[model samples]
Target: MLAAMAATEQQNRTWSQIDVPDQSGRVVVITGANTGIGYHTAAVLAYSGAHVVLAVRNLEKGNEALSRIVAAAGHGAREVHVTLQALDLTSLDSVRAAADALRNAYSGIDLLINNAGVMLTPKQVTADGFELQFGTNHLGHFALTGLLLDRLLPVRGSRVVTVSSLGHRMRAGIHFDDLQWERRYDRAAAYGQSKLANLLFTYELQRRLAAADASTIAAAAHPGGSNTELMRNLPAIVRPVATLLGPVLFQSAAMGALPTLRAATDPAVEGGQYYGPDGFMEQRGHPKLVRSSAQSHDEDLQRRLWTVSEELTGVRFGV
Candidate 1:
């Protein structure tokens, strides 16, 4: 159980406060870039000069987000890198189509942000008949990452940043036997499994890259308690409590995106590390390196999940 990362060097920075480094030649693909934390993440990165491909499910939303980013960038004498592409994470075919489109369009990808996800919501199946949260949040990204890993490998120092949540601490880890929640479907548990998978995927991916002698880094980050569209499916009663607690405990979307921005842009980070807010409960504040749950680092489950994911998606990740 050795540490995967070296000494921690957490930071305290906001999106606007971030130092913009030259990213003109780099390309990044972010899922769920049309709204919420994903929107802010993409906008900030694009505004800083990284050509951003927004992999989203809805073209209308993606175009709208692109327009906003473009318009916003016009004011500061900065030309933001931005583009919109269709990606429905609920379907394996859709995931492949998006990856193929990116591979065909770009020579190398500097960053891949597995940012799209679903929260605690009703039980539904994706196009492939898997549970909705698990499918869209974890499996979809797994397939997409595997499919595009070759393109990523060629770009030395490339990184894959997966967005997870503090809810991961709640469920503890994956329920391998009932991962799909066949017997009983607790929405929160399902979401927790998906989030935990994000961490596991990050670590397992790093292990694979090392085994293949690749330098690509895989890291994870969480937004804390940001006001994002992730709460769209929560019970109506949950809003008032959240609203009341938000001002004191939650952060703005821009603030919430800091950790992700840092993980994406910071040169000091290492593979298999995680970042989140540094405030009380690690719920809201500036970006900082943080710890993940014990289950997140379970090697056995990680390998099993990797095999299952490859078999299910028929995609093999490359070095």
Candidate 2:
């Protein structure tokens, strides 16, 4: 009877911020951490006692976020180091420079959270002449990970957590022939492709790390339907309705960051795993181990995407 009671309690347990283990002495680098889900993720990690680097495109905003994180974490018993590193995920040049700077600054890194990304925007291209969403969300993070994987390889319990999205399942697939969408473009489809790429990158990276017999693991997560600044790009006609239904349609950014935090810090998390909310349609709730689209798990497609990403970014992964 006692065992049954304990089992019931365990099954009913709700994982919250309190479940986040001590992160002291660990180093965390989060991109696009100046706002929204990234900011919240950084804040939680900083509070839990990790040295965090906010890699953002806007140094000014990054500084502001750093200050906010420090302020929120407070100077209670221990001090958390929070710094800013300028990184523009849309440009390979910026990604390379940021990676070099980070590599020079830290002898080892515990976590690299590829959380920066763009949403549905009108037809646009990155500085590297690639689709805006695909280049910034997928190629940029891919390059950064390859550049920094060595530093994390030797660090026990190190993780590369890339933030993907449920949108990965929405009209998303690898369009090899039209990688850049030069033939045609749909904002939603393009965003879906980028999110799907994030998962593909994470899985492929995990496979490589495993093949190399490395301890560092790669994981992926999604924010669910959080009402973050990313929603600003919602079609104008739907904006008003979305605003009216915001309370029902979206959860807070702090809540959105939970799945990512869990994936990054949860010791039980394994390589090639994906996490997201536990609510309806995996939309909003506490973090839970989740499954990504079937297409995302295709090994051939993942390998092909890796090759294409390497060709486009000119960055190679030693793993």
Candidate 3:
């Protein structure tokens, strides 16, 4: 029995650096690819010979990231094609425009990584007048994915990988009545809701894709407490504590990106799967398949969220 258990554990194991396959001929679009986990993901994919489009809000930062990725690629850089495209997730118009630009430039996208997000920010509304976190983290990606559905559907093995967070476990639920949080707002709770929405979106998208019999899939991942810019929005008090604990408690950005890369590229990965770190509490380690909260798997909630997201974004998926 012990031997059998050990075998099972080995079969259901975490993915490592050697597990990543060559990505030649693949076109990957990663949002917020200018920094942190996004940048690391883009760098690795580019090095593996994929055409990586860094969909970022800031063109200068995106170009800078591209340059750094190229420099890191060394002689392999010749085969890597990294381009920058402006994408501001806070605005519906910007999301639509960016999707349109991508559709015009690329015939198909093999991977779409929704990796950009804000964390624990003070109460604010997006240009669309929705809560900042929900609007950008969930609604924005929903719109972009819907707009790019045409490009993704026709391509074999296409995928949409949304990045959620461990924070999703904390007091997180869809606030349908106050989706915008116009009444009472707690920064942490708002961030949690947005992350939970990411998972809900991913699961619903996968269901729709399967129903449509499309070759594409949807998946979700989390960075698992890495030292990244996403923490810049944390409360002032928490920021200093995080800084002091950074070295010992947090993993590097590159390590944090593994789960996302695995979700996007792993051949054995199934639709609706969530990836995170293999370490204690999923804080830091190599990438592995991880279980989300019970709420994340609620089908009724997923459908409701999907409908509301469609209404807000004004973009409907073909799936």
What's the TM-score of every candidate structure?
0.94, 0.95, 0.95
Tell me which of candidates 1 and 2 scores higher on TM-score. Answer: 2
Quantify all predictions' global Cα lDDT against the true fold: 0.86, 0.91, 0.92
Q: RMSDs, each prediction?
A: 3.2, 2.5, 2.6
Worst 10 residues of 2 by lDDT: 7-16
Flag clash pairs in model 3. Answer: none
lDDT of 1 by residue, 150-227 (tens): 889989899999999998887656777887888899998899889988898899999989888897999999999888
lDDT of 3 by residue, 11-82 (tens): 378677567799999999999999999999999898888999999999988889999998887873456799
Q: How close is candidate 2 to the true structure, as a TM-score?
A: 0.95
lDDT of 2 by residue, 101-150 (tens): 99999999999999999999899999999999999999999999999988
Error of 2 at 198 (Å): 0.6
Pitting candidate 1 against candidate 3, the one with the higher TM-score is 3
